[model samples]
Target: MRRLLWLTAAALLAAGCSAAPGGEAAADKQPAPRPLGGVLHHTAAEAAALHRAEEREVRECMASRGFEYSAVPVGDGVRRRAAGNPYGLLTRAVAAQDGYGLTVERLQRHPADPNAQRVSALAEGDRRGWEAALKGTRDGPREEIELPDGPTVSVPTDACATVARRALYGASWDRDRYTVHSLADTIVRETLGHTLVRAAEREWAACMRDEGYRYEHRKDPLEELEKRLDTAGSDPAALRTNGREELRIAVRDAACQVEAGLAEQVSRAQEQVEKALPPARTSRLEEFRAAREGALRRAGARAASTT
Candidate 1:
């Protein structure tokens, strides 16, 4: 679900240029300072580096096994992927350039995976070998890990993906995945639903209505946009029109987020909510965070080496 009710954030962030709601005292101040540190924390730069490193690992591994793989750039396909947290804080540059980033995603020429073309082009047996090598034998001792929220997920010990994680996140990669994968949204929801954030939502909703978008909840416009997009189908002109409309709605949403201090509210609430979690979960979160930072460092090094 859209980042699990971070409202439009189920999608992100804000830097609104319009006049803010508060008077001179508020106007004199900048946006509220946000807190740092969470179970889910990765700046866009770190994320991009990690993405590149992981893709390189998988690609190189598959090549060693006599298969072709092309690392896809970060896109919508990756955004909602399990175990990823791209729910970036909104900024003015972000809103003006990308809105919620979906329009750019929608307009892309490639699918979620560039390698889909290669896989489709392969002979059946070759394709099976490729899949097996990348994912490993599903029935053997090395199967996917089971989690609280979903069915068993494969991070097959024998697979390229698992190898990539190991290289980037060290031996605790599996444990790290287990800790953070299912809880990303859970954490996001708790933070967003905190009292402070709830109040901020009310103000944001009011601001949206004032802007002529009657969205009681932040995700409303996105939901509406999706439904409207369904009617557009594949007509180029229709898609372009919808894209433009999406940008319009998103720009306003970003502005409203700023006027309401939603981003700051969520960040602060997240810090508080995380502090209140049970000790066991808290420990696991700490472990996950350590792994993430380690991975970022490794990924950055790899990126530099390649350059």
Candidate 2:
């Protein structure tokens, strides 16, 4: 059984800059638009006010873009648990990405600005909850499932693989949504990661050259190992085993360097974004993407060997 793993990026739109809450002058109190997209405010009072303004702006923005919107109030019971809880609303719009179909969902009011630690924590909690529910449902006998045989093969159609893929993509989208402030912001974050990673690597190479360090930057260790295995096809198993271990070590080293680089970049980027954004919703989209790419690379290497 071959597993088909498909992921579709969600089409997001900045609901628009919102105001927390105010009566007649609410429109005048709207927070300044941040460079990243929506406005972020610190205090619940501010967030509430901005939230209201955003609700109105988002509706207008959608209408200008030819979409409809409505408001949904969270009951008092649930609102109390949420600090400075502001009423949430849903927006429905026809966008090119949705094939011009009706799209409706309540925009989330995240607790704080997008931070890597917060994003990862949220993803882990979600994954744990999902696993717990799955465990509760599986009270029957256990059976061993077989995986496909190959150097790099597709996911299996087995139940286990299906579950794994769902889990993986769920986490992927969860992280994506967490970092994404708006649809435009998501696109920019994704594009920036691809461009920045290459640019940063190039910069690192330049730094090495200036320092006279004879370091070679291999694009993908797994590919390099695969090539060596092809040459030693008669002893493929041995070559593959060796290659897998070496790849793991290489990945660990690469991951460490990437982590350090990401830390610095995230800090710098966050600072820059915050300067232009309010305290509530500035995003850590770029950092999230960097981490996602690193995980995908590691997962790919593991899949190649396991298959």
Q: Which ten-residue region of model 1 has the weakest summed lDDT?
A: 1-10
When summed lDDT is taken over every stretch of 10 residues in candidate 2, the lowest stretch is: 1-10
lDDT for each residue of candidate 2 in 1-307, tens digit (9 for 90 to 100): 0001000212112121122123212322333222233222133333343233334433344344332344223222232222211111101111111211111111123344222343355567664443333232244333332212212222322222233333333334333433443533533344335444345555544544444443345234335544554565545355434433432333232333343343234334434444554433434455545444444554444445646
Q: In candidate 2, residue 230 scores what lDDT?
A: 56
Model 2 sits at a Cα RMSD from the real structure of: 25.1
| Model 1 steric clash pairs | 2-10, 3-10, 13-90, 14-90
lDDT of 1 by residue, 1-307 (tens): 2222233431333333343345422422444233225435455666677888999999889889888888878754443232222333444434544556554555554547887887989999998888888877777446457665557766668888777778778877786577566665556767767899889989988998998988887768767877766787766666666665675677677667778877677777877876776665545666777788888888888888988
Q: Candidate 2: misplaced stretches above 4 Å?
A: 1-199, 206-222, 229-262, 270-307
Each model's TM-score, in the order given? 0.75, 0.23
Residue 151 alpha-carbon offset, candidate 2, angstroms: 30
